[model samples]
Target: MGGSLVGRIAAVALTIGSMVCARIALAEDPCLKQVFGRYCLGGEVDPLLQSVPAPAVSQAAADSLALIFPDGENQLYVLAFSRRIYKVVRAYGVSTQLRFDDTYRLLREKYGPGEDRSQFPEYASTPAARLAAIRRGEGRAVHQWMPSPTWHIELSWTRELGISLSYVANALSASRAARIESGL
Candidate 1:
């Protein structure tokens, strides 16, 4: 009888411990609800565009909504659904080259060197050529980093387009994400 009671107690203790651990893990999911100033990647989408700030201009597509904020020439673009964010792009406008440099410096300081760097050369012979190359999607550079197992960040730049940042969530499976994203 004593042995049976001890076994039952151990089982109960284990169940309680497991429940506690599960709660902790769920509470600390690294897929940040907010990564940038106030934007979250891969979570419930904001109801209003003004949830952050009124965009200078906005566009919508079948799968996404884009907002452009021209404040400070930091032309920020955000793509989100009514459920989650899929992509974000922030342009530097006129200060494309300078912003690109500053963004690289900041990323290095914050997250160390990126895991992968894909940089295209600027082969343009003239200023117009460089601009043309950038417009043609040439001379584009991207540095990617995995800040956490669930979150990935990409810093992209082009001579003519300036700098931008992107964040993605990789923790959820496609089917599961689709369900959550669809509010099902």
Candidate 2:
């Protein structure tokens, strides 16, 4: 009878310890901080934007909306669906190789080295040649980081859009993909 009581006590302690550990892990997750400045995934847009000045332009679509704010030469785009922010993007007008490298280093330091998913032709072996190809719209430079299952970060450069850093909510993206796959 005493042994049964002791076993029950031990099991309760183990369960409580597991719950505490899980909560701590979630609080320390870096991806939680990777969302838009003060805004978070699945959070409402109005409350989050209250502290910031009004966006320079706003566009709405069938299911999503975008708010564009000017930041010097760059543009910050906040995209949302159902009034909840799902993605944030900062686009730099001057897309130089140096700028791309600097941004890449900063992101690497914070999130560890991301996957370099740049696509270049066989002849574009050197860094300079790759940059030239990208400028000519023949290739694209992409670096991606999946810090957690719920968040994704990508830094990409293209001739049409220049250099942009994007943060995406994976759950929202998966839902969009599902709709596309189902042709709905």
Top candidate when judged by lDDT against the true structure:
2
lDDT of each model, Cα atoms only? 0.66, 0.80
Question: In candidate 2, what are the lDDT values of residues 111-172, reduced to their tens digit?
Answer: 99989898998889998898889889899999999987777899999887799998888776
lDDT of 1 by residue, 1-184 (tens): 9999999999999999999999887665333647656666665445446565677777875645677766575666666654456555666656555666788789889999986575445566665565566667775667888877766788876655556677766543354468568876
Model 2 segments more than 4 A misplaced: 1-36, 48-52, 180-183
Considering only N, C-alpha and C atoms within 3 Å, which residue pairs clash in candidate 1? 45-83
Poorest 10 consecutive residues by lDDT, candidate 2: 28-37
Candidate 1 lDDT for residue 37: 66
Clash counts per candidate, in order, are 1, 0
lDDT for 100 in candidate 1 is: 67
- Which numbered prediction scores highest in TM-score against the true structure? 2
- TM-score, candidate number 2: 0.74
